[model samples]
Target: MSNAPVYDIDPATFWADPYPDLARMRAQTPVCFVPQLGATLITRRDDIFVNEKNVDVFSSDQPQGLMTVLMGQNMMRKDGDDHMHERRAIFPTVSPKTVKNVWKAQFEAATARALDRLAGQDRADLVKDFAMEVSAEALKSITGLTNMDWREMDRVSQGMIDGCSNYAGDPAVTAHCDDCTASIDRHISERMGALRSDPDLSLIAVQTQAGLDEAQMRANVKLAISGGQNEPRDAIAGAAWALLTHPQWLRAARAGDISWLQVFEEYARWISPIGMSPRRIARDHDLNGIALKAEDRLFFMFGSGNRDETVFARPDIFDPSQDIAPAISFGAGPHFCAGAWASRCLIAEVALPMLFERFTDIALVGDAPFGGWAFRGPLSVPVRLR
Candidate 1:
């Protein structure tokens, strides 16, 4: 040990290439507490899985925790029985039956509209326009805020989360900001008062009818939009970027002998948009031989775990043939991502359709910059999309 009181885990490494730093961390100390980062960093899948189930040890209840502040106590932010109950209330809405009956067709429609906007363009910033547009629209439908301009909301929310760290300027009073989230709050205030009866499919109705209040409903709605905002866009952008960069995979996808679902599994693993989801301890805890006090934050490196040499062979390379269901990129345990189906739907219905239907070859034209701590993905992916 260098006796360095702190080592600021160079976050920018995640932007350039997260794997190298992750590899170094896993090798040096899989459970090493980085004082600079203000928490323990679990480098293995088993550590994260064990801690997730043992929520008493992990303590997900802290108010200042990332989940508390951003997403609130819908699911990922809480522990034990209460967490289970809260999660179950709205969980039915995302079920396969619910999705097949409701979410999928609407999602495909949104996909069509988004791809229509990009039809004749030779070059496109997939991060800004296409990916974000489709993500915003899909979330809007899922949450029953269909009338809102989801595209702008997605953009602003993205800018805001990216603003969480390293905005490099006055983030508070920044007039040009407040981005998508400000709109969400505005929408809630404007509409929540007027709509005495909730829409049939609204996320609010799903939970409120299941037994919640106006305040709790507001938390769920805000959580739905804010936390749900960037995922589809990031997943799609990163997947498309993954395919574009790896021509061999694209060829395989286009060749089309295997089912599309299989292609998507490869896409999800290969891109792995959300490298980690950060969590903070609600109380004192210990696991995997590491002990921690209350209020200590931990970063669950999902990407690192996916690439763990113990589990994955040739972990660095982007391979479509591997069994990625074992991976935790969409999270695991009780806190698994609710938007996973929608995320996968976007890739299948929107991204791949545009890709397979339109162009022959796509190439990455420049370096891909990433944003956010928990929901990290390419910020702007420039490509020659012919």
Candidate 2:
């Protein structure tokens, strides 16, 4: 291990371009400790599968830290039966049936309206103007927070995710998280009263019916907003980036030679939005020959695992037609993303097709760089939409 290359997981470098560092880690030290993060970074695909699936050995119930701070005591932090109960309660909202029978048209309409707003503009930031707007609107529709401003809700969601990512300790991040939490609390309270007087088919109503207390309801709402908004938003922007940059794939997608769903999958594998997931070792164990003690923090590098050479041929290439394996972007095991169906529909069926239909030609106007070591995606994808 002495000969293993050392990589810094700092904000500046890691977020700038994590692939190279992640590649090195995967090659030399697939399970090595990073002093900066105070945890072992796991980079290989198989290793992450093992870690995510074996919840008994690597627990998701992290004790009152970054995740709990940002998301509260929600399903993301729960284990065993508690996690399943919380997940099942909210499953209907994000299930394939709900997405197909209910949310699909709404998602399409939201994307169409967002694209309509961008009609007059020669150039626009895809992330801000389109992707973020659609994601925020979708969350509003799903949670029945119609009165709340989508932009404000997005700001709160972003703050919670940013605080969780920069969990090492940043005063501004913490303050923003606190403010977001308060806002969520207020929204939850309002929704509770609304449910009593006039109920609707929303996630809040579902949770209320499940008999979850105030804190659990708020935490789960935060989790839904944060997970639902950011990952899918980034997925849209990332798919746009991939398609625009790789014209062949774009042409195939537009010409109906490839399924839009396949394009979305390839984009996710090529540029994972949520790059890493945090886990804690439940007890003393040996992982891929590396000794891990109890309470050891582990950062499962999903972004790296998706691009593992062993998993995908020419892993770096953005080829949607290749026989690509399923990526770990939405994660694995019982903790797999509940919003997966909705996210896929929003991106593949609604957002991507809408962008293509509205714009004759799309090209990057400036450096639309991808960042965020943990939650990765283009910060601003400035494009000329003709």
Candidate 3:
């Protein structure tokens, strides 16, 4: 075991191809202090699970952090009964039943519409033209912000994500986030007025009915936009990139021999979109012999855990047939993403297959470089729709 600090991995290299570095860290220093991140990177699958499950020791309610800065104090940052209550308040809106029944047709239509827009293009950047557009449309429907421009919605969502992921507090990122927050405030206020006059079961309306005040409603709505919009967009692009790179799996997926759900899960594990989640240490504790101090930031590297050799056989391989356990891409325990079902429905069942069906012979134009420190996925997937 190398006792060296894990900050040796360069940020640029890790962003480009993280699997090798993740494998090395998981083997040598699964729970080492990273000076760059100022957090103990928990890379092993079991350790990540333990950290997530033991929320009392590793608290989500950090006094100051990126998530808190961007999302405010929403259900994601809450603990214990408060978390449960707030989660339950919005659970019905994104429940699997609700997503499957209410959002399924909408997702399919959005996917088809996105593909229709790319019909004549000899070469298209799926990330911008398809994935982002479909995800924006879905988010608009989910939040009842259909009147908002999809391009603006995409820009705002990306800004929020980039700001949160920018651990160094980039000025441009902060400005973008500030702008997004102002826009969201206006949107929420308008929606509140509309709901007062006449209400439907959108996410904002449901949260309002569940007794959230204006501030709480705004925070949760921001959370919804950041998580709901960004992750699914990346996942859609990542899944397509995955299948495109590994054509056999793509064929299997199309042939019905392998389920789309399986392909989605594999793509999520292979290249997790939301790569890591932060938790504040409530007290000094020892995790696998490493002493962690109070208020120490702990990052559960879901992307690393997904490829943990101890838990996953041929961890680096992208094989959908293997019966792998559920990845922590959507997180675990109380902080598990409330919009997980909706995200899966949008990406795996609707968007991914829709792209393949529409462009039967789509080919990658060039390399698609995946990026991000906290959130990981392809920046763009340029494809030729022949």
Candidate 4:
């Protein structure tokens, strides 16, 4: 084992604001091991972008990993052929063509319904009231869990996310995640009968038609809910907060000088919702002079990579006009987020513009403080909507 820098941090403080530590790591020891996290972090953009695709060395399959243990072995936990097979199966629901032809309208309707709910309110937390509602409603349609309440979708997603990230072995978090997975399994079972009789272009329906077993189906749905709900939810609210505070950009976007899609992309680059992805070293390897052993836990810090100084100009600032083509907010490997198109369409094409249009003037009541380095976004975007 090669000597790696032992970087110590107060987990609480790091969770609140990780950029400073990340930037420090990038400058000093980009491949240091954090004992608190029990994982080696790769902070540079180039390193992750290059190495992430090398799945032979940095594999995704980890049976003992938190996500696999807590949420079952979903495609995201698989590698190579296994991952691709699952990705292809679910592609019908999230493919760009499908998103444009089918889900976009559904997404618009969901956003509209969420906006209607906010019509009566003057002040509200966009995180819960608007963002969460819009994302959850659209997720229900996409996942074919229309029988499940929007709140229930959000609840289970959060539970699984917390459980997967529960590195401290919090039994309560693990138990909650177990409960969430159990609920998902029940929902999947309930919906399967109808889906077989009258199949549609939802994740569960498509995967079922593809002949995935019950365990796999449940895992995929749980995976979708885990990411599908929160990332877009956070992006919708986070991008709104970003553009609202940066009025010049918001005005430009509303005026059509800057595209809403551009704003979404930029905000995603700035504060990536799916921040760190955990990987297990599949074999002993040398990465940029740092020795990595087989089974050593590692994290590809997508958040830090998006803000790499060498790649992005003024990487810390959120600029819609800047070229974000290089950002790996959705990842760059075979395990890249399959719902990228759907998320973009939902947040940019539907949720953000519709919400702004519905309310004449939407302003922040106060600062909306953000939390979480792994899955980061505003805790509550308290805003006054007119």
lDDT values, one for every candidate: 0.67, 0.83, 0.83, 0.92
Q: What ranges in model 4 sit over 4 Å off?
A: none
Window of ten residues with lowest summed lDDT in model 3: 1-10
lDDT tens readout by residue for model 4, 1-386: 33578788789999999999999999999889999998899999999999999999999999999999888899999998899999999999999999999999998988888788888888999999989989999999999999999999999999999998999999999999999999988888899999999999999899999999879988999999999999999999999999989999989998999999999999999999989999999999988878899999999999999999999987999899998899999999888899999998999999989988888698999989999999999999999989
Winner by lDDT: 4
Model 4 TM-score (2 dp): 0.99
- Candidate with maximal TM-score: 4
Root-mean-square deviation (CA) per prediction: 3.3, 2.0, 2.1, 0.9
- Comparing 3 with 4 on TM-score, the higher-scoring candidate is 4
lDDT of 4 at 331: 96
**lDDT measured at residue 85 in model 2 versus the true structure, 0 to 100:** 92
Off by over 4 Å in 2: 1-11
lDDT of 2 by residue, 202-246 (tens): 788777787877678778888888787888888898899888888
Comparison by TM-score, 1 against 3, better one: 3
Model 3 RMSD, rounded to 1 decimal: 2.1
Candidate 2: give the clashing pairs. Answer: none
Clashes of each: 2, 0, 0, 0
Instruction: In model 2, state the lDDT of residue 140.
Output: 84
Query: Model 1, stretches more than 4 Å misplaced?
Result: 1-8, 70-73, 163-180, 193-198, 282-284, 360-367, 371-373
Using TM-score as the yardstick, the better of models 1 and 4 is: 4
Winner by TM-score between candidate 2 and candidate 1: 2
TM-score: model 3 vs. ground truth: 0.96
